[model samples]
Target: MKRISLFLLLSLLLGATVLYSQNPETNLRVVSVSPNAASLGTFGMIPTSNYVGQASLSIPVYEIDLDGKKFPITLSYHTDGTRVAQEATWVGLGWTLQAGGCVISVFGSNAKIYSANYYDIKGRVVKTVRSNLLGGYDITSTTYTF
Candidate 1:
């Protein structure tokens, strides 16, 4: 009976590893913002001019030490440069990356799937993010150099 129980636990553990995504720290990378958002990231700037700056890349969730213990922090996943990343502090979890007018919600302990309209410089919806899956992990973040 002991052996059977141990085997079951090990199998469950392995299954979880196979299903979970990679660690966020290992995968985060910074990239350029969408061309339109690039122009808009800066507040009070010339509205009709091209803009550029370094933004923190958003990545998926993995175990990270925010306050000593391992916790999964889902961030605003983005490949382009991050013009803004407002940290949305969870009441009992980790900080959420809340930039780019994109958002995730925690309602009565349940997380809401994020949804919003995204546009390119040409004002077209180039990307769409809406999921029945309540939790989507963060992305790998990195910076680019000229």
Candidate 2:
């Protein structure tokens, strides 16, 4: 009886651990800059995007720069597409800034997105690590990225 109880407890603990780690509310932010130092080149503008995933759902938001204005985009979840959200809701009004690169946000964590990236101005991946997240739990992450 003692051995059986111990085995059952270990099995339950392992299952719980697997579920928590497998389906975590992970968020990823990407930032890249141009090699040129003159101006915001055609593809030099460092766009911002995020993927808030909880359980099996996801909510992705991307901001594309045009001329001197920033466009707000909110794409919904999709299962067929490779990049998740295909249909989106465009709201041309939102807060955006381009200090060193085009800034974009989804929740309220600007520093999280900015600091999560490991790439520098040369577009090369550097060291990357973070202690904790800068946003809340997203319960609507229908789609996710690997």
- By lDDT, who's the top model here? 1
Model 1 residue 84 distance off true place after TM-score fit, in angstroms = 18
Give one digit per residue, the lDDT tens place, for model 2 in 1-146.
99999999999998886463343434444333322211222123333234532122224466778898976554222222223422222321122222334432223223333334353333344444332233232222221111
Give candidate 1 misplaced runs (Cα > 4 Å): 21-146
TM-score of model 1 vs. true structure: 0.17
User: What TM-score fits each model?
Assistant: 0.17, 0.19
- Whole-model lDDT values for every prediction: 0.38, 0.35
lDDT of 2: 0.35
Candidate 2: lDDT of 103?
Answer: 31
Clashing residue pairs in candidate 2, if any?
57-141, 57-142, 58-141, 58-142, 58-143
